[model samples]
Target: MGDIQAYLASKYMSGAKADAILSRSEAGRPKKKKRRIDQAVPVAVGDGTGLLIADEDSLGNGWGQAEPEEEDTDVPVVTAAAKTLRLKKSNWSLPSASSSTQPEPAAEEPPAESSTATATSAPPVKKRKGGLLTAAQLKEEAEALAIEEARKEAEREQERLEARRRRRAEGIEDDEDLANDDDDDVDDHPDHQRTVYRDRSGKIVDAQAERAEQIKAEAEDRARQAAKKDWNKGLVQRNQREVEAQRERQVASTSFARSANDRDMNDELRNEVRREDPAAAFLTQRKKKGPQRPKYTGPAPPPNRFGIPPGFRWDGVDRSTGYEAKLFQKINERSRKAKEAYQWSTEEM
Candidate 1:
C-alpha cells in the first residue's frame, strides 16, 4: 500500500488510473517476477501499519538488512510509511492563506492620461482685473488733456492780438494812421505855448505882423554876430539890407537919431504903455469874442474832396451812425482834443 501511494504521488496520476495500472501489472498477477507489496496485501492488518513478504531467496539478503534496520527498533518500516504519506499530502494540495483574499493593483494609467490631456487642451488665459485703470484716474487724465488744450488756445489768441497791436503801431492799418497824422496837435515852438497864428479875419495872416517878426529875428542875429570877434562882415552887410527893406514895410519914423534924455524918457513911457496894455489882457479879450473851439469826445476825421472839414458829420446828434460818419467823427474829436490839451499843458508849463 505504501509503495502504491508513493507511485500515485510521483506519477501525478489519478487514484483510478493508478489502480487500473496496478491491476495490469503482470508481475503482480501472472509474471514470474515477484511483487512484495502485492503479496503482503492480504497479510496487512492495521491502519498506519503494513506488511512486506518476500521469497525465501530474496529475503536472505533483505532479511539481514531488515535485521540491521530493526536494530534501532524504530527504523525501516516507520521511515517508509512517513515518506509515502508526505508525498501523498503534497499531491493533494490545499489553498494558501495569502492567495484567495488579496486585491489586484489599481489602474493608475487612465488618471495620468486625463491629467496630461487637461493640461494640453485648455484655452489661453486672460489678464487679471487689477491692470485696468480706475474711474478717478481716467477722469483726471481727461481733465489734464482739456487744460492743455485750453492753454494752447489762449496762447494762440494772445499771439494774434500782439500781431494786430504791432501792425497798428507801425501805421499799417488806416485807423492807426489817422490817429498819428495830426501835425496841429504838436507844439510848433517845442518850448512855448502853441499860438494859433490865424489871419486878421481869423482866416488870413497879417502881412505887417509877419514883417515885424522878420525884422525882430534879423536884429537878434545881428546882435549875436556883433558879439563874436570872427564876425563875417559880408554876412552883416547883406543882413542889414534885408532889415532895411523889412523896416520900410512897417510905419516909418521921421527922426532917426535920439538924444540921451529923449531915449530914456521914451523907454520909460513905452514901458508904462506895455504894462497898461498887457498881452495876456489882449488874448483873454479875444477868447471872449470868438466861439470857443468845440470839445472833442474821440479820434480825428478822414479826408474828403476839396480838403474842407474832413468827412461830413453833424454837431449835436446821435453819435452812433453809419460806418464812415462814425469813423470821421471819432478822428475829428480826438485830433481837436489832442490839440487843445497840448496847448493848455504848454501854457501851464
Candidate 2:
C-alpha cells in the first residue's frame, strides 16, 4: 500500500499510467460497500428522455437487467441511464468485467428515527408531487365542502327555531325580523332535486299533498280559537255570580253580631261600632220618643271587693249611677264614725 502510494506520488508518472494504477486499486480495494436497497431507493425513470448516464453496469444494484418483453428495449436502457445520472454522486461499485458473479440489490431501509433499522444512516429520500392541489380532486372536494357548509347552516336555522319556541314559552318576546326569517329555498327543497327513489312525478304529488295538509291545519286552528272564546264567556258569568253571593253572606253575618252586642248592653263596644258607622241603627242606642233623662232607682250597693274607693260609676246605664253614689256615702259615714270613736277611747285612756 505504501509502495503504491509512493509510486502514485512520483513526478515521473504519466496520467494514463496513474489512471490504470488507480483503477486497479479500486478493483483490489474491495468493492465499495454495495448500495443496499435498504439504502438505495428505486424510482421509475422516463425513457428516451435524453437523460445522462455513467456505464451499463455501474448502477450499485443489478439494475441494468432487461425484462422479457423486447419491444421496448430502449425503456430499460434509458431508465437505467437516468437512474445512474440521478445517483452517480453516491459512491457506487461495479463488478470487474472478467468476474462471473452479478451483484444483488440489497433491501432499502428508511431513516433511523422513524424506522426500525439503519440508525445513523443516510436519511430516506422522498419524491415530490407536481403541484399543491390536483385538478379533478380539488373540484370534487370543493363541491363536498360546499354541501357540508349548507347542511351546517340548515342545522343552525333549526336550532334557532327551537330556541325561539323555548323563549316564547318563558314569556320573552323575540325581535320580529330575526325570529321570522324565512328558510332559504335550498332548505325547503333539500332532497327534492336528488330524486334517489322517486321519479319526477312522485315529487310533485308529495308536494301538493303536503300543502293541502298545511291548509287543513290552519282551518282547524281557527275553529278551535272560536270555540275557546265562547267557552270563556260562560266562565266569566259564573265567576261573577260567585263573587256577589260571597258579599251578601258577609253583610248578614255583620247584622247578627251587632244584635248580640246590643243585648249585652256593652256601651263602650257599641260606641266603637258606632264610630265605624255613626248614623247606623245597629250602632246607636234606641230611644222611645221621650224628652226627659231617665232617673236612677236601685238596691243598696254590694261591697267593693278590692278597695277601689267606692264611687266607681258604671258609665253607660243611667239607672246604676245613683247606686254607686249611695255606696260611696255609706263608706264615708262609717269612716267618720270610726274616727270619732277612736278619739273618745284615747281621751278616756
**On residues 1-349, what C-alpha lDDT tens digit does candidate 2 reach at each position?**
8446646646457777676776676666534332212222443333345544445333454665432333323222323344354553333334366865555688888656675445533344333346787777677666766666776798899997788888888888756634354444555676746534445666434556677999999999999997787775777786897777986786566655455546434754545543356467554455558687544344344455354432344443344446666877898999999999999999967
Most lDDT-accurate candidate? 2
lDDT of each: 0.56, 0.58
Error of 2 at 126 (Å): 22
Error of 2 at 294 (Å): 99
In model 1, the clashing pairs are: 199-204, 298-334, 299-330, 299-331, 299-332, 299-334, 300-331, 300-332, 301-331, 301-332
Residue 345's lDDT within candidate 1 is 90
What tens digits encode model 1's per-residue C-alpha lDDT throughout 138-220?
A: 77666766666776788898887687679878867665435444534554546346354685577856567899999999999
lDDT of 2 at 212: 97
Model 2 segments beyond 4 Å from truth? Answer: 1-132, 176-349
List where candidate 1 sits over 4 angstroms from the true fold: 1-131, 174-349
For all predicted structures, in order, the TM-scores are: 0.13, 0.15
